[model samples]
Target: MPYVNIKITNENVTNEQKKALIKGTTQLLVDVLDKNPATTFVVIDEVNTDNWGIGYQTVTEIRQDQ
Candidate 1:
């Protein structure tokens, strides 16, 4: 079984978009690694912008600056 974890900022991601992400990730693994979709696992984590940081600043701060 192959396990994949994906993390993204907690923005207003719709359910349809999340479903597409999960399906696409699984398909990629299937195509590249010959992994079975039935056995592949994909988990999406939505972190608060304040909790997700980059370059010594949180995503919230980065977006604010933008």
Candidate 2:
């Protein structure tokens, strides 16, 4: 059994989006790596935009610039 953990932080990510991401990523890993879905666990951790930083800038701040 292989365990996988995934962390993603995005201001636009909703609960549904997180669920889809976990499911999709897990499926991909299982299909590509031939792992068992039942034994494979995927964890998605959502972080606040203020806590996430990119190049010394907050994700929220960066998105604002974009």
Candidate 3:
């Protein structure tokens, strides 16, 4: 079994985008590593900006600066 873990900030990602990510990831694994898609697992973890940091600032703060 192949397991893939993806982490992204909770920035209002759409359901269709998430689905596309899963499909693309699986396809990449199949094409590159010859992994079995049926047994492949893709897990996406959406993390809160407050919980994610960039250097000394939180992602929330970073975005506010931008």
Candidate 4:
């Protein structure tokens, strides 16, 4: 079994976008690794900009500073 996890900030990505990411990545893993699509799993997490960090600052802070 192969596990894949991806994280992205909550922005323009919609619910459908998240579903597509999971489906596409799973298909790729199945085709290239010869694994069952059912056995592959993907997790998408939507985080607030204030909760996510970059360097020593939160994403919200960085965006404001820029």
Q: Candidate 3: where is the Cα deviation over 4 Å?
A: none
Candidate 2 residue-wise lDDT, 1-66, digit = tens: 776676667557788887887789778878899888888787777788889888999988988899
> Candidate 1 lDDT, tens digit per residue, 1-66?
999999998899999999999999999999999999999999999999999999999999999999
Question: Stretches of candidate 1 above 4 Å error?
Answer: none
Query: TM-score of predicted model 4?
Result: 0.82
Measured with C-alpha atoms, the lDDT of residue 4 in candidate 3 is: 94
TM-score of each model, paired residue for residue: 0.93, 0.73, 0.96, 0.82
Residues 1-66, candidate 4: write the lDDT tens digits.
889888899888988899899999999998898989878889888889999988899999988888
Alpha-carbon runs more than 4 Å astray in model 2: 10-12
2 or 3: which has the higher TM-score?
A: 3
Candidate 4 residue spans exceeding 4 A from truth: none
Clashing pairs in 4: none
Ranking by lDDT: 3, 1, 4, 2
> What is the Cα root-mean-square deviation between model 2 and the actual structure?
1.9
Flag the better candidate by TM-score, 1 or 3. 3
RMSD values for the candidates in order, in angstroms, are: 0.8, 1.9, 0.6, 1.4
TM-score result, candidate 1: 0.93
